[model samples]
Target: ANNPIWLIRNGELQSFGPDKQPIGTHGGEQNPFTLHEMQLEKGDCLYLFTDGYADQFGGSKGKKFKYKQLQELLLSVHKQSADEQRRRLDETIENWKGGLEQIDDILIIGIRIL
Candidate 1:
């Protein structure tokens, strides 16, 4: 599976580094993780997150949140301050999850280029 890191700059969202799986002992053989290098300018927002956010099941139809929708959600909030972005993301997912039990661990790291 390709795991992508999300980037937002000038109100546009870009995908990068469909990197390998998570670093863990579950793999059959030990493999080095891929290295991704990118130059970021001021105002650029970068997000690294686990699949839990997208894999969560919710909404009216009780469907997975999906990556596309996550991308859009991040794009919509990337310009906000880090605290605000965190709040919005948390609120959005909570609202989306509703009363469903969380199925996986969720982790998201956001960095704003300075």
Candidate 2:
């Protein structure tokens, strides 16, 4: 998954992660993964995910769902509880996929600080 990290801080939705590598192998360019630090306020949320969902081939034209739509979905669900957001995300993907078989493993984690 190219896009592995996302954050909603201070009512803004932003994406963060390394550009050269994936979860392992250190991207070949470096010996170790680069780390980032950010300050979070109350009610802030963090998200980490793999590319399965966005890479899915579906929709009217039968193309990949892509990352843009997924980002919009996350922003829209920002007002909801974590569990409800999860449900809506699952529902959206399932509906998008329709009867087609799922092709890859999809993983998403949502963390909100109160």
Candidate 3:
């Protein structure tokens, strides 16, 4: 997992803090994720993901899909469109998981610079 950041209107740091320290928003009650403004001139891409994708189980016999594998997969399909990237990633996960039941919610967001 990664800490999400945002940049809106004049690069204002609209981040919340508690006790003068960077804390979750809404009185430190919510962990909000945001992608304020994306800077993609062209031929650029961004991949955001949650832990469930790597925590999945199934492969050959049955094993957790490690982060390394996910990174490799992303690198392999980095050239595809956002939609295509999502499709391929989902397909890859499904194939790796085979018939294993999903353990948790999986979220993957891909933004292509176009």
Candidate 4:
């Protein structure tokens, strides 16, 4: 499965990076990993995260949290202090999870360009 990497740059939330094809040492001719390059402006925020966050089963219908919703959530809180942003993200996901055990590890990094 080709999952996209989410990113936020200069107040714009977007997703890019990583090819959908699986990587293996065995018998299939697979696409090589793409080399992505980007420039960061002062105060820009960049995020690198695992699929677990978006794939979480939660919300009103116990559906996946989703990339779009995640994007919106981050956008709304991007202007807050870095620590505050992290806290909010954690709190939001935890509430959404509603005490369910997540199958995968949740790892998200938010970098603010200076």
Best by lDDT: 1
For candidate 3, report its TM-score: 0.63
Model 2 residue pairs with clashes? none
Q: Give, for candidate 4, the lowest lDDT window spanning 10 residues.
A: 1-10
Quick one: ranking by TM-score, best first? 1, 2, 4, 3
- Local error of candidate 3 at 55, Å? 0.6
lDDT of 2: 0.82
- Candidate 4 on 1-114: residue-level lDDT in tens? 356655666678777756767655657786668877876678777777778889998776788898788889989888799899989999999889886778677877787777
Q: Which has the greatest TM-score?
A: 1
Clash count per candidate: 0, 0, 0, 1
Stretches of candidate 4 above 4 Å error? Answer: 22-27
Superior by lDDT: candidate 3 or candidate 4? 4
Model 4 RMSD in Å is 2.4
Q: Give per-model TM-scores.
A: 0.89, 0.87, 0.63, 0.81
Checking candidate 4 for backbone clashes, the offending pairs are 2-20
What would the per-residue lDDT of candidate 1 be over residues 1-114, giving only the tens digit for each residue? 257778888999888876465565574765677777888999998888888999999998999999999998988888888889889999999999999989999988998998
Candidate 1 lDDT for residue 57: 97
Per-residue lDDT of candidate 3, residues 1-114 (tens digit):
242321122222222212323443445555444425545456555555566888999999799998768766777777766678778988998998898899988987766555
Error of 4 at 15 (Å): 2.9
Assess the local accuracy of residue 32 in candidate 2 as a C-alpha lDDT between 0 and 100: 55
Off by over 4 Å in 3: 1-41
Off by over 4 Å in 1: none
Residue 56 C-alpha lDDT in model 3? 97
* Candidate 2 per-residue C-alpha lDDT over 1-114 given as tens digits, one digit per residue, 9 for 90 to 100: 357578987668887865655556543454455677888888888988888999888888788888899888988897798789989999999988987888899988899988
